[model samples]
Target: MAGVLLSAAVACVLLAGAASASSSSPRVFTVGGVERGWRQPAPGEETYNHWATKNRFHVGDFLHFRYDKNDSVLVVTRDDYKRCGADRPVLRLEGGEARFRLERSGFLYFISGSPGHCDAGQRFTLRVMAQRDNGAASPTEAPAMSPGGSFNSTPGSGSGSTRMPPRGNAGDGKTSGAAPFGAYHAVGAALGVGAALLAFAPPLPATISDPPSTAASFPAASPMASRLRLGQPNPNPGLSPSPGERKGEEGEARKPEPRREVTDLGGGSEVVHIPRFMSRETAWEMFEHLDKRIPWTRPTIRVFGRSVVQPRDTCYVADKGLTDLRYSGHQPHAHSWDDFPVLKDILKEVHEALPGSHFNSLLLNRYKGGSDYVSWHADDEPLYGPTPEIASVTFGCEREFLLRKKPTNTKSQAAGESGETARKRLKASAPQQHSFLLKHGSLLVMRGYTQRDWQHAVPKRARAASTRINLTFRRVLP
Candidate 1:
């Protein structure tokens, strides 16, 4: 049944080329890794299923893959062909390299031939569009590549194995009218990422990959498993009662305790502000765990108008990792959360501490050495609503926390309310001030009125500091 579905899918895609066209260069795809066999479907083996881009592909285009037949087979087909017994032939190739002319616009998928190979980890998709490209020649040969050549090293990075067709190869050497999709990894290599494979295609099913060292304690099956994978710093230092907590300016709701708070400096204007909220001891332990477990590439982020590199050790603190608090934008890699039990426990405490608070996602930022800081910004994602609650926990190093108001206009839209009435309302955004030091094992919750009115940041200090680790829990909408 699966074989028939695949065969039909291939036919439809190959025939759909006459109508629309592509706008990018013909892409040369490659695959390699643990699943060495690339061709020849093994008994009961399933095909790979995933897309190379968010958009579809058109005709006169080619998807060339250089892979091992013994490892897996790359199949290209239409979306409707995935049914158990559907007759389809998404392009199939094995051993060495093979090219398929996707002459249609629809879904394309691939699978391995080895026994249970596809079920283990071997499938991907490419949505083929139904447009024709100006007559283009396929490349004469493939390029020299490496084992990890397909992985995108940059954050929000694209795949690297796709070779742009040579000049004059496709329409002006580019696919016109086609949207750019990020690079994709081939079958064998995709399996090599070591993530647990799903027999079917649902990603959030019952099973999940084993958490890496730093995040090892939680059950791998839970959705929160993915959230602990990321985090960031102390942007808002103080906590006050959210609107729901408070009444209309009369007898207000009880405010959060300001046990350890930091103060904002010289603030009177509205701008997105983030705070550096944590103590020194806490920062070290987090790094110690990360350094011991996951592999991290030393990277820097722009914060407080300065480009600072997060040092892997204490020495580089003087050179980078320190900056002012005015401008902050930090981007760090996702941690392999396999061992950090504290995170799971901390989250549970947060939920119980503040029942109404909610967060579905998390971003992790590591300050490997002294001087790492994240600037101010409001946590106003539309999906989380006007008054979202953000729980930021800090580990390692002690840094300053500053909170300021966002510009009235930006604040208004983000707060999801308007005018003085909005201001008077005790939502997550309001002119509230507070700051606290996040020591080792410390957790802070930012709820209500905060995202609407205030912006927080963690400015870099010239002090001889240590490393810091911060995690911000959030809920992002699809």
Candidate 2:
């Protein structure tokens, strides 16, 4: 009994000492405009930062929104990120301020949910100070920083003293008119001549006339130089052009109907109705041709102690042709300038038949659709350049094309004609996939804003009607 009593007494003393130490330490800290050297929270973003030092904030810490030229503040975070405990704290601006208690801890991020504000770069962070006592006071005092340190809300809003040096620089933000670092500046005369040549180079094939026959003429050359010189109306005008000659002149400018008809799908979508777009016979022929070549092999990648098989393939490359037609479970076919001969022929033929588009490169997707499918993804590869045009041709079994808009916030939905709200619009100008029966011999063109704002997929079919082959034409980086 004596030993037990003594042990209890000592334990009590240790506990008391710990409690005393915690009570004396400062637990509460404040974060706001005072800490973030800014006049307002990034013009339109909701700033973020903790009120305590380190990861120590707990329930009851107050968050404040300062007065600024702007009206209100909104906090936003991705649904997945939020569920993962990395979302920004949810707080609102009303009357003069808003507050939120730190109920939990982990990595958290946030942004202003205002009109295009977050897209403008309004972001911040907060690392709560470790808690020493549960009785820590609320965030009521102003944050402290050394002299020369201050907040600038619009610069980059948040509850931290992250500052930017005066005299705007590339590091401060994106530079507007500065030339590239280490740019090649040629000799004065040589550079001047080169610039002039580039500026005045012919915009298209020489066969094309200066002014287009329609109102949408390619604005080639200066408008003044290309203006038609019309002789004075009646002063000495000869008898009005004979009927035959008059009709000839008018017919010269009248656009010809596309030899290949286009099936107008309701809702502004249309498909090239060329007879050879695809057919059962063509699909079987392509399969036979591919079967004679080497089969595709899957490429493997190791990640986190596991081997990840990427789209892979195995092909025999010869000066003349490839001998393999198999899915390699990889993407982006290996093509080079050497392939230009055949490619040029293909482009020439297409150009002669359909004069509205031009092809620069070819991207081959070997989907030996034996047992796999590509997940939903956007092909925004930069090499394609901005507003790149693409053509997709399919050979073999028919399959469904699945396309969906990039999901976004409801409040930020884009408005379109008919005043309908759309999360995404088809490059064809409608918010739907213009599905085609991409049969053998069929070709589909994804031009205009396709890559700029939409995504596409060729999902794996449970009972694939039949094995299919797809080829996509693109303009690789020059």
Candidate 3:
């Protein structure tokens, strides 16, 4: 009985210690200190590197950036950091007074996203030291400002001096902690903790390294510069069993389904073809629902000096708050997305299949027969932003989708040529073209710089064809 009581007391003491350690406050460091804010370093003045080297940053510590709204922050790769390039940043933060927590135990790079700021010494590289066994605080605790303008620190802790630096025009000197740091925190905390605890953890050197090769995991395709080759066979074909069908019926041999296939188009362009993305029955049901229920319109555009009606019927559906979309001289008003539940469900499925791609608007096209088709053009509207991922879902008849590479020097070469002459030259010098027969119940995704380099169209077919409906999901930026 005495021994049992002693063990219980020891367990209680350990629990108390763990609770106390977990409550420790994360240290917050001002990016350029209180005097300078996030300005460029003066000649021979202490830069961010100088200040960072003076302190010991742990996984849970926060780096607070206070700057003007015009300036921005970019979390970039090591190569981008060295060149001060802002393109393709790993992460970007705009506005003033952003807080980034150091969640991993390796090197992290940051730079000013504003033009010329990075060149003027407004960048920093931080190395987070490995965490110790002294139970670190959870990454979720919101950083609240205390009366002394410092982050709230635990009572009787010596790290209380880490406070917000004074600013002349800073608003409220407080943060709501509403930033989307959850993803960063989770990734960092898991990696940091796991690396520290595991004896067989891979050696994480504190230097920039090349990205791991994904070639072994993915197949290769032809290297045609200006042509789209026929897409390869589906790697993992067939309909995945529905959730209800996946449950136990032990020892039942499941038939293999046709797999989705991805084809590389070079220049960071690719197409993902998903065979039978939806079951045949579901696809037909959706096609019938959209065809009968949608309020389709025949929009007109000025082509060849005449106001010609479009060849195909179209409808625009968008989220409730999005502005009307205008493309190719047609300003189409968007229908409320709530009116289309089937499309919303389809969009959800597309989102699940393609991670990181989010769609806010869908442009639906109805090709009544072989005669209805669209001309050559790229969906490169400014509203879609710089580079957009378009998820196109096809239902009904199969049609040949053609792609032709745009002339690289069209503008420069036509500088002195007449408009007609320039157009003729471009047609004569057009690069190799490619085509794909988009099947019913399949999906095609166009990614990367495809819009800037390629133009696509569905040419009219010579023979009679069944009605086809296409839903091209897009993200319209505010």
On lDDT, the candidate that comes out on top is 3
Residue range with the least summed lDDT across 10 consecutive positions in model 1: 211-220
Ranking by lDDT: 3, 1, 2
Model 2: which ten-residue window has the lowest total lDDT?
Answer: 208-217
Q: Is candidate 2 or candidate 3 better by TM-score?
A: 3
Model 3 pairs whose backbones collide: 236-258, 236-259, 237-257, 237-258, 237-259, 238-257, 238-258
Candidate 3 regions exceeding 4 Å error are: 1-258, 408-429
lDDT of 3 by residue, 227-291 (tens): 13212132221123333333234433232444778877788877778877875535654665577
TM-score of each candidate structure, all chains considered together: 0.31, 0.34, 0.44
Candidate 1 stretches with Cα past 4 Å from truth are 1-287, 295-342, 407-434
Candidate 3 scores a C-alpha RMSD against the true structure in Å of 24.0
132 Cα displacement, candidate 3 (Å): 50
lDDT (10s digit) by residue, model 1, range 312-412: 32111111122211213643333322234434444555566556665545556666554656556776656566766666666666556666666444454
State which candidate, 1 or 3, has the greater lDDT: 3
Given candidate 3, what's the lDDT at residue 181? Answer: 36
Question: Which candidate number would show the highest TM-score if scored against the true structure?
Answer: 3
